[model samples]
Target: MRLALPTAVLVTALTACSAAPPAAVTPVQATPSSTPSVTASAMPRASAGAGEGLPAKLRFTQIAQFDKPVAFAVRKGDDAVYIAEQGGRLHAVKGARTTMIVDLSAEVSKGNEQGLLGVAFHPSGKWLYLDWTDAEGTTHVTEWAFDGTTAKQRRDVLTQDQPYANHNGGQLAFGPDGYLYIGLGDGGGGGDPQGNGQKLTTWLGKILRIDPRGEPYVVPEDNPFKDTRGARPEIWAYGLRNPWRFSFDKETGDLWIGDVGQDSWEEVDHEPRGRGGRNYGWNAFEGDRPFDQGVEAEAAVEPVITYQLGEGGSCSVIAGYVYRGTKIPGLRGHFLYGDFCAGWIRAAPVDDPARTVEVGKVEQLSSFGQGNDSELYALSLQGPVYRVDAP
Candidate 1:
């Protein structure tokens, strides 16, 4: 029951120029033309840390594989894992068995970085939510009821006209507050072309929180912009480029946002559970450094962790959750993350602000998921989903 807008109408709506002026912001650092070199020694290996008490020998095994699996969610009490495919399908995984739960290929727009992107389940386990790019290339957030075995009864809850396909942010999760939060990329093209990242009038380039129990979802009265003029009332935070993945610390409810960078840096921003309405630096700044000098006057939030694309032998940061699963007691409280191209998995205790030690490595880590038992699992773009257990 997702709503479909004609492609022509979407194009016209996105192209309609807005009269609002661009906010002053700093410019991002220039990207180098050549690819940076990575030494063989820089590559990571499986290594256990004293903090998480991981076993001496650790390895990963494939549980399932798909054409282009992008995101996954685990039901609270059920053993099945819900996997989202970029080609517009939701696959359910129970133990080693897999089955198709829903298909929306006709409504989905599959192109460069645009398709079925994210999925999540309500805490009550009664509903599943999906985020995707529609045929016209706009982002849509929809919810469907889960009747134990299959997904039934769909509802198109929210849709945002996208200017371009490349930077459509696609991560969705229900926070501890029982509110669903959706991430949207800055209207795409090169370098945030439309200047939507800092624009309050639009929901593009924001982390939006809404109560889905209402018709088409309702904006929470406590939203940051509840009293602001000309601002999208549902926005929880603004000024993000393309937040590819974000997660709530299962225990703390704090939010961890991984924003993809243009050329110089990849960043991870932390928002404590109750805080909202913050502005992350995008066009005016990349990471902690200033990009555009003009936007410095506007309040900007800094990332808790950042690394240069080339310096750390990494590119395209994939943000992950802190391990709170029971399988690896030693890894509990460790923040696990990896790079799309580097093919390395590393975990540093969340308590360690400096991230001094490495927990271990996983080859070609694509996405991370936590099970109903609180155990951690790692999905490989070209490999299997492995249970992150003690060696």
Candidate 2:
């Protein structure tokens, strides 16, 4: 749903609470535990120079404009940036020319959170994928054969019935391992009343890994839950509320997720390469604190970053990428992220997330894009797309 905004900040203090033991194999869990906070004294010091201050001052140059652009993507070795609008039109923005690449407005749902949500290109650049909600509010991850100028031979890869209108986790990326990774939210109701987050049998509230080239899709043989009885074989990780956006560091292959919290807190989760089967406390925890009192969470991994929900008018976290592009030397190895409501962008070193610094801002920020050159771009639901350039 289109979220309402709050005008003020509500400070969030780190709180700890012991949870009752976890139930066997069922969904539901406690809020998570918080990691130790990093002191200001530990942060990288700002300097006056080019590429200075945590990564150098950033200039977001307006590169293109679209109709409610929600996601951006890049094809391998291609200079064009693909923009996906909530209304189901995909456009290729290359230099001064913008071309319509695809249109599915008739098939996409019109809800605030529904519609065309994410787009990605396969590593081979021959395939394009889209994650969107149908008219019935069902999520679909579809694939198409793309030959640069056009897309054809459409096929369905995965489908899930969403229980509610909001919290449709729509993020798709091809990981370093060459497998397609998909993020799904805990089937949308307040606090996961359906208990999908910790439920092994369901794909909801999980990050799934599969080879979309297979018929429909093929679960990787090495998937974390592939051999686990009653578990969805495609599941790589579970226990997430709403993973709005996620990306792999181009250089390190680490996974970074911006999982929107229920209330009070918002978080960014980081998982090192090859660490699958992680449970990021959802109903059980919200940004390192207990959320649902009745649910016992598994050994959950706490988020590396958390902030008050209304801190500086912040609402949902929009996860970006780790800057590895040569255009900004100081930005290399730093993870970039922002908030949907607050519209401010910040960056933290991959090695030390707590040592963060504000870098830029984009009003109505919906998503970020990393190009084939590894440079970054930010999208706004209001239409403008900006390229993050060194100032």
Candidate 3:
């Protein structure tokens, strides 16, 4: 929507998988699920091959296409991949067939980074979670029961009124800790029009943690600002401009965030498992550089890696996943990422041993999805979702 970088060095501002081959999908009556979230089992590592350590030669294969598909997810123990169309429908991509699961078109307003921006299946494989903006420009994190074809039993997990349409950081993921982590951008307009990033009273421009089924959604007691005065306890981390996409490392439990840039620098922020309360310095700074002198940066957690916006056809940085899939021998521990406009698919090792490597490029890359086996798939907003592969 918002026309939406890499490196190494291991500079420590540093704080900070595999599982069943998918069981049959079980439809539920959209009841509130109290079951713990699913954690990925460790995937077997790939043994080195002839091309091991060979210069990378990546290729893209189109698996499927959809209209304005912005987000996707795999069920806890199922192989079918569910895709979210911005106009408000979830589609399933399995083998040779594609089917629509649900439609919320009457409730969604599509335009300018607004719409159904994210989707996720509950750990029990029964419920489906969605993060999207409604026709009134309000953000809603809703849960519905999935019967493999239609969505039912709608439940509202959370909601926030947006001041502007753009910068609605609506990505959602259930962390290894069994809590849902939400990313929200500062209330849109140019440069954080409301200065929401630095304020503790609001959830915008912050990563929030909550239990979706606990008493109409309860904020976790362990959240960073739980006891802080004036700070909304839902905030797990504050001061992100627009963290469009972020995921938890299935094996290591680390959190990876791709925070979109304001003017020049796009950045990647990392946090170790079990750590929070760190400030990422949005208004005070942008991508490790002093930005707004008006507010001094205090104990800010700078990005581990950042790339200039104008480089490599770069525009907005789409923060992607750390490859733990065994299909690509050389991509084992590397964090795969790309840009919306530049279309170049690049990766930096999660361990940061080597500098960022340019893998390959594509057109209009919007999002990246992981299969049940941990393999990586690239979703282009234009239509084709490519499977990133190598010989």
Can you give the TM-score per candidate against the true fold? 0.84, 0.87, 0.85
Error of 1 at 302 (Å): 1.3
Tens digit per residue, CA lDDT, model 2, 70-98: 88899987888898987788888776777
Clashing residue pairs in candidate 2 are 29-284, 29-295, 30-284, 30-285, 30-295, 31-284, 31-285, 31-290, 31-291, 32-285
Per-candidate clashes come to 12, 10, 7
Global fold similarity of model 1 (TM-score): 0.84
Candidate 3 local lDDT, residue 281: 94
Q: Rank the candidates by TM-score, best first.
A: 2, 3, 1
Question: Candidate 1: global Cα-lDDT?
Answer: 0.71
What candidate 1 gets wrong by more than 4 Å, as runs, is 1-58
TM-score of 3: 0.85
Indicate which candidate wins on TM-score. 2
Q: Could you arrange the candidates by lDDT from highest to lowest?
A: 2, 3, 1
The parts of candidate 2 lying over 4 Å away from their true place are 1-56
lDDT of 3: 0.73
Task: Tell me the whole-model lDDT of each prediction, alpha carbons only.
Answer: 0.71, 0.79, 0.73
lDDT of 2 at 284: 91
